[model samples]
Target: MDIISIIAPMILVFFGYTIGSTRIITGGNEALVERLGKYNRKLEPGLNFIVPLVEKIAIEKTTREQILDIAPQPAITKDNISVEVDAVIYWRVFDWVKAYYEVEDVEDAIGNLVITTLRSAIGRQELDETYSSRSEINKTLLEELDKATDDWGVKVLRVEVQEIKLPDSIMESLEKERAAESEKQAAIFKAEGEKQASISRAEGTVQAIEMIAQALKGQSNSKEVLKYLVAQRFVDANQKLGESNNTKIIFMNPKDVSEGVGELLEEDTHISDERIGNGSN
Candidate 1:
């Protein structure tokens, strides 16, 4: 019975030692071993053996990729505009030893670094540029963060600027400015159209007068032709005035218009005859 008791204790001790020393590290995870509270070596995934009582795990961390979300924070632009900005950081631990010993808290350190860098980046750009140059800002963040966290054994894969918000007053002001610009453009277009139409009408009148002069030149009844044209134009003018709702038009006798055109044509013919006589002499 004494031997049986002794053998049972031995079996328990052996099993205890074996179970305590054997560590099953899951995939995508790593652990650092320390001897006497000092960093000794890093244990890889799968079956790992450590000397119990003399060795202990200092830190265990996942090597898999991680996401760090930065909360929305206030930043000032180069134009002296205060704005809110937020971002997301994709990172993963590459060297477990450096990640554990180099920085006290990897996640916290990265987050703080991102805040500082983001502010600096925003300070270099104006408010309008901040909205348009989001891709540039994100690229700058990734480069600077990747460079800064190199020693921490952390790799910053990508950075994205989520949203940029403007103050309500600023948005309202911009909307007003855009509306004013649109109205100004519309007015200018209308004025140009009216001006073009007036020029086209003037050109048409000049062309019609030239065509009539050419047709009546060297004709025996040119004076009669002029009288007929003047009477027709006066009748057309009266017709247009009668169509209007607001015009107070005075009607003139057609015989009076014919007499006036005949007198004007006689004066013009006398002037031409005098010019020809002077040239011949």
Candidate 2:
């Protein structure tokens, strides 16, 4: 080994070591360096330097928004309905050192935590609430997840429920219940309409009688005219009874009603002559 040969080999080694120690971290990314198998420092976006063998980039992660798709989980509601629920989580690694050191598998730990939390939340709510209160559920999940993931150096941006599936039989039963409820409401509305109409008809009948009495206010044949109006109303009432869907025993005979009205008018005997005179006119 002469001086030139030794110097040439040392120069090559230095160049190789310098090139190997340089690390380039790109946009929206970070790296965790571990010195001798212990946490040393975090590397931010852009060029970074480290000893080639003594310091290693333990983990590299994107600081930008990330998505984690949760597998479908089985849960039972308070109503005892079995359902499969799946969701997507928006999250990002805020601390690369904690994310790398604190958990064995960050993604797996988050997924399991979400699944367990969901099961617990769903178990407290009824099936109807689970379907109707999707926004509330998502809000609640986001809050819980954020709190739980704080120590893991993860920030949960949002939680979105992707799907909720129930058995076909349960769906059919819910449909039938909805239809039955609609029919019940319709029937109630119909009955109310009929009741209002009947009340209006009764009020009209009273108003008609009052108008007739007023028109014959001082007429000589007023008594006879009133008797005729009463007799007509009796016949109308009987006709409605016959038209009704209900089977009814009508107690008042139409002829008897007419006779009673006629006899009552006979008390105003002088009106009989007046009625005859008006008829002739």
Candidate that scores best on lDDT: 1
Q: Looking at candidate 2, what is the lDDT of residue 113?
A: 93
Q: What is the TM-score of each candidate against the true structure?
A: 0.71, 0.69
CA lDDT of each prediction against the hidden true structure: 0.87, 0.84
Model 1: how far is 246 from its true place, Å? 19
Candidate 2: clashing pairs of residues: none
lDDT of 2 at 161: 88
TM-score of 2: 0.69
Query: Candidate 2, residues 50-153: lDDT per residue as tens digits?
Result: 99899999878898888999988999999899999999999998987778789998889999999998888888889889989989999999999999999999
| Residue-by-residue lDDT tens digits, candidate 1, 76-145 | 9999998889999999999989999998999999999999999999999999899999999999999999
- What's the count of clashing pairs in each model shown? 0, 0
Task: Give the 10-residue window scoring lowest on summed lDDT in candidate 1.
Answer: 205-214
Q: Model 1, stretches more than 4 Å misplaced? A: 2-4, 128-136, 208-281
